[model samples]
Target chain A: MDDDRPLFFHVMAYADDADHDVIDMVSGDPDWEPPTALREGLREFADAPVADYQYPPSEGRGDLRDLLADRHDVPVERLVVTNGGGEANHLAMACGLEAHAGNEVILTDPVYPYYADRAELLGADVTYAPVADDGALDPETVRAVASEETALIVACSPNNPTGAVYGESVKRELTDIAEANDALYVSDEVYEAFDFSGRFHSALAFDSENVAVTNSFSKAMATTGLRVGYAILPDHLVDPVRTRHMLTNVAVTAPGQHAALKALRETPDDYYAETRAMLESRIEHFCEALDAAGAEYIQPQGAFYVLARFDGFPGTLDNTKRLIDEAGVAGMPGDAFGSAREEWLRFALVSPRADEAADRLAAYFS
Target chain B: MDDDRPLFFHVMAYADDADHDVIDMVSGDPDWEPPTALREGLREFADAPVADYQYPPSEGRGDLRDLLADRHDVPVERLVVTNGGGEANHLAMACGLEAHAGNEVILTDPVYPYYADRAELLGADVTYAPVADDGALDPETVRAVASEETALIVACSPNNPTGAVYGESVKRELTDIAEANDALYVSDEVYEAFDFSGRFHSALAFDSENVAVTNSFSKAMATTGLRVGYAILPDHLVDPVRTRHMLTNVAVTAPGQHAALKALRETPDDYYAETRAMLESRIEHFCEALDAAGAEYIQPQGAFYVLARFDGFPGTLDNTKRLIDEAGVAGMPGDAFGSAREEWLRFALVSPRADEAADRLAAYFS
Candidate 1:
């Protein structure tokens, strides 16, 4: 907890220190332009009266909540807008921990580091259930690990580091397991829009009342730094989550909310389709280059990342540093995600120059 | 902890429920525009690369940090830009609690409600040191309540609800006591710019290693909705505060930061002077009206709020409700700040319509 470099910061710092010409695939930030609606929305917001710049309702501005409520099909009362997907997830986890008469917060083995870091910060006991070799959840394995003592089970689909979209059956199993164990399912679907598989399933579809779905505009709208996200809570957790949200941040920033509201209302559905298409091409391009180099990798089903295994390397941190220094390419170490995947390296196909980054990796691996 | 209405939300709810003709002064949100520079800055930022909107450094962007460092004359390493002054206080208190070999987090009697809320949420044992009837701190009272069991001493200058600006000696004594008690002094100076008494002193001015100062652009920049604030930490608390900050809200929103950076760089010195002058006039006008109506009030030496005693009412909640329903004026109850001041009703002199609001109060009382 004391200065153990959180993975995101470590990767971003590595990218910053790399050569100016380095093809940075380390950070998850998308490189493409945001929708014109988002940029235009800022200008429109700037022109509004200063009163609009004052504190918004701590829960959120009503219009944005209504928009998201309709989009997610959740009641407006269950939603609490947050600073970003991170806060949304954090709030849900906090709620779970408080209600947790449990000993451990269960997470996937190859976890999003932020979740692990937050669990530690909140003093919740964390335990991991391993993902399949293909980085997909094995429902029984998760069920085997969870119990009345399991505070919450976190599921990330089109997952960070893995990009293995959980299949419908797996989603149903996890939801059922959480419901049976009296634990909450924190389904982080920030990557929902980026699914390569048309069959992206929300845990909410299962109707278990125990699910809290957290999502953000960061990845989908290409505005990660805007710090706006929301959580759809179970009826029981609504008041507590609202209280925690109020005590923690009061509300999300105003202009970001307005821009997000505008983006949701004005942007076309085709924009998401185009983004998916563009990112799929990038993923395929990178994987093909990796395939040509004969590297073992989990082909991403969704999200813009691929986890490639490199056996000859001297662990991930060393490999990542050498890769940045010698190959002029940057990707995250698998160990950064979790200790279980130390031989793997994760690449985010976020940059427009991702192809060049892949080619650099190919040459280095060869 | 079970749904006690936090002050701002409670007041805003009353305002929301009141008739359209209500003269609302319930919340502290300034009813004024942010500087022209801040508005124009958002326009400039909107055109930047999509990556610029993706994520900023978790601690903060260097340019903004550098600007704040120059402004506060603190080392850049000692500062952490937070979501708002609320977060700055939260993070600093977190550090103090972790370091405190103590049982209690010391607060001023009739304290800002958010601090107590945060302390309760963090599981810190909260104890109060009484402020004099004039809403001024008596250092000995704080010292008497504190010992090795004190984890933190929170001092708000241009204090909320009461607006009694602490003098130099009081700040020094508080810092010295915190140092002696092995506790941290979290001095919230968000209202530093609004101090009518030129004698306002910063805890940082004492040069105690135990001191941390939190401030924000919310009140000073008239951009509470923007949610940008910062803390200047003692060298020791820096890393822990950063960790807490990173975990709580990964980073402040980007455009808000850009606008804040612009405001800091481009706003003229006279803006602060003019704001103080305007708020002073409003406060003076309201107090004169209250005096004419034979109402007891504390003359605010700083900040924009005036807490008036309305003894005829049963309690603050009832008084505030009837005031909103009958008199068409809204303000927060003193009980919301703490249990010690239920007879008081806090009016934020933030609206351009402050004079009109005061007239309504006078007419109702008469």
Candidate 2:
């Protein structure tokens, strides 16, 4: 029942082999310009002294960590710069399992698949708590499923696929629930910058020791290829996470961090606002096409994904391939996430051709 | 008895806190300039299209993987580019344990600490096979430790601390031993480019499915900060390793891989030869100081470390700290490696101040 290969790669390979021109909506890689200062930083770092090319501190470059600490309003000791938000999440899960008494991890249904995959890789028993129909994970639902055996509870917001941004009350209650259950809550905020909803709230705002906030510049800075991210941990988890990070990755890319620092320092709020405006327009256009096709879709409140279900067209591996072949568009089948979303399909509005892809889908269905 | 902290960071922290000038001999981070072409590549990539700043293939950039596969004389399917040799080794060990029936891992005594740390982190039972006094692991010693329950056997050639390069015969026999024991042999060849003696041989020369060779450009290209490395896995292990890499790191840094690719394509043989020549001279000069100080030392056969023992100054943590405060030189306490070499201190000679540091050490002891 388990396909060890990630869903994105499986569908992507099929897309690559398609004879027709396929507009890719399956991958979350943003196809926008990165901050200009990031490129300038890369060029500048090409002339950095030899020591800068040797090794940054395992935790991270001092200045980058300091900047992240300032931004997050956490002490510098609470941060660890990672290879990406991927490694940050990996470290959090591993550390959570190690520190807690139980080997079980609680994840939201219609989950980001990597959370479940990583929990399994670290030998945790995973149990899913189904999200509400609106794609919001209720704290009560988490509390219902979580037991003393739950070592970790992982949630993402602004969420992937569903794009439901958890509000302050919801995040606070989830943190409290995890703390009561002796579980660590790993909140992936990688898409935080994409939140269009005013309700988006970080678990860090709750100031709970159980929460680890994982974020990356991949989505926000439009530079996933750079592979720079960080985990802001509770004081207790810092050392173990740092050591695990060191053993697993040694350190993040020096030049990437340098570029990220430059971008963070120099990129104006207008750049982010413009990006959000761009995505909002794409979302509006795509949702209109969905209406024309008579497909039911969750209008994303935050991240750049829309989950939709077309009547009589179940989102399965075969159907995903069919869409690539017949409709000239690619998307992730809902079953790739979890059982709760098996009849749905997820499309990332990352490509500039999002409108064209949406129109094609509308025409194919109509 | 477990400190949970890596020894390097512990000592390096003390070194950093020292008020006097301290020649850092504790870190293996090379001080040489990376290939000139690498800087050129970084500058060139600053102008790459937006797509290039998005995610590369999870396995790695295709051209970099192809180049590595060709260089190693392995099929492209055998390669999994990683964050560094650290992650490559972590993958090999984890995969080895998963694929084998046993949970026990055999490691060389005086081991690279990360090997043991990672094994424990993965919940494997670790046993040490002591190397010979000259710091060479005899195949028979490994054979003595092998059992049906042995999942992995790890070794490093041009070894850390001891600097003994294993020859072809020893490596071949080691592979045969692992195969006979139904175990995987992970050979860390990160220092392959630093072999000062003509004795260094990669376990890949044996062409055994039991062998996985891990290497990195961190040492060879002198760019540890770039975070680029790969593991040449046996056919059965590649898929699992690749999946683990994706879940853990997503992908290596695109810019770093681009730079590494350019350096690989353009670097002259003379560049490597000159590096080896420079290291050989340092080894010679450092050994001369050891003789003058009337200390016993293992003259390095390869790599850039010298393991030495003074008459009364044991390589304990206290003495290591004392050296930093008094002698103004920082070297790792050998006890940090493993119990087998607790009386010795390991000094990495990557600093341009290597001769001066050696002189300081000799005068301090005299």
Candidate 3:
């Protein structure tokens, strides 16, 4: 079946085509400088030998994979460099479905839409387990829905749209539930670098063959255009996913990987700290404007998103468009996510214009 | 079912791990310089605005797509930029299967292994239509294999391994056969720029709604590591393939695309002519050496490969390894392509060391 989820590009296009000046909060693309080292890396690659521009190992560059594996406390064989977190998730889900003896995939309600879209694309029957009102996914909800037919269970933290970071116990319990059901637990940790709560726990911490952790440099490095990311898969899943990756994309971009490796190695810790501080300030300012408008909003504990519910302004597609035209602001309709958040609007606080977007929303609603 | 095709990496690894210096002829990666403008493009992008580092349109960069659309004489909506020709082929095949009401796919007997691997990966039943001894595919063979159950027929012009360039008449007839059987003809033209013979013709000339043409910058620009490619698809297949590509790759690399765009715009025609001339010389030199070894070889009319059958030695995995160890030369076992070429060895003539590899083979055989 075709994916019925909202196309992000359509909303972005609407805002672009609007007559008035609109502060875009609909896109998750970070409006910040990538690390200086990344720029240097690109320049360095320009001078590399011709042979260096040929095919790299399909798995990834050995130095980069080895470095990542060391950082994650896993062997090099357990990881694969992918085109982006998108492909990483796709690979994990496809391999999970192939390895397990089932066709059903359990996902969180108010989920990141791509996860649901990928599950459906892979021909998995999807079942949603709704999270609590504050966006915390209770492992109990997952346990209640899981069955023998459940081939995969996908969870993201700090979660997109809602930004609830899963702690160690929650992650361990989710892994346990997946193992109990003979299913693979796919953990999307692309926002790991954005955790403000300090509660983010990687699924890799759990020593189980049932867990696959996917992450991307796009979000963390603020270089979404680079298309470099990876998956840390379990032992049994490694070869299958690598083969699938080879057959699908051949290999990740060699220059991108070269630049990523340079950035990963040379970027200072203070650079990340400064980014976190900047986003934390934007989040506080935006939440104040929401309070002024008398809107109920979840102040994200992690990640750069705020989910708000304005009375009499349910987040439907029509209203989302109306906000772009009349309010001079653009945010995603909550219905684009699952039913649980259908009455809310999700704004990505990645743009430097977050404050301007907040002011417009406050004024229009008032 | 899992693909049982020979892993190209394993062979390359064996050659790499060998004690002596080996002349590698197994990989099709070109050992030539990319357009000089590409390097300048990468350097220029290093100083680009911060906003440019965010996600590009998932389909591709707009300017690049428009340029390609104009060149191919297709509507921009009918084109999609992909990670590589590999993904372009994957998308075309998947969409073809989804659009048609059938499970069987017809392929060339000595096919590029990845096409068969992908068909099996997509769960399509594969049937082979054998090519003639000289590597010309007859439309009649495809017609004999076609039925109500066939969904797709794949063909490659300037074919890999065998290097057969399909002319206009053959392409038109193949497209006619596919149309009559209600199957999509997925024509891979990745080696479009490598055609030395005047016989090569694009399937796009047939003006059929059931044909999809896939090509890549990897071969033409000698930039396999850049990972940029595209598919010119039929109207009905465009949206489905775009959605699938978005879910799978998010997008191709930004800097790579930026460089590709610059190279495409600024590189002179002489650059391509020089590359072709170099390959033509290597082909002549390599064939003479093969003849000295008393090997019956198909002298490639186009592309950078030659298939040769030695008198007593069959091309098997063991023999491929032995050549790497003893002769200090590496070539692909013909069985990797398909059963029809099992007794022959395929050598890629991309390396500057092609003459050295040919010399090694001749001396070893003598």
- Pull out the clashing pairs in model 3: none
User: lDDT tens string, model 1, A269-354?
Assistant: 99999999999999988988888777888878899988888657734677787888888888888877787788888888888898
Q: How do the residues B181-214 of candidate 2 rate in per-residue lDDT, one tens digit apiece? A: 8999999999999998898888887889999999
- All candidates in order of TM-score, best leading: 3, 1, 2
For A62-127, candidate 2 gives per-residue lDDT tens digits of 999999999989999999999989899999998888998799998898988888889877878999
Q: Which prediction has more favorable DockQ, 2 or 3?
A: 3
Could you give candidate 3's per-residue lDDT for residues A284-359 as a string of tens digits? 9899999999999887889999999999999988898999999988999997888899999999998888898888
Once superposed on the true structure, which residue ranges of model 1 sit more than 4 Å away at CA?
A2-20, B2-20, B311-315
Give the range of the ten consecutive residues with the poorest summed lDDT in model 2 chain A. Answer: A1-10
- The clash count for each model shown is 1, 0, 0
Off by over 4 Å in 2: A1-6, B1-6
Q: Estimate candidate 3's alpha-carbon lDDT, on a 0 to 1 scale.
A: 0.90
Clashing residue pairs for model 1: A83-A227
lDDT of 3 at B74: 83
TM-score of every candidate relative to the true structure: 0.97, 0.96, 0.97
Question: Which candidate number would show the highest TM-score if scored against the true structure?
Answer: 3
Q: How does chain B score by TM in each prediction?
A: 0.96, 0.97, 0.97
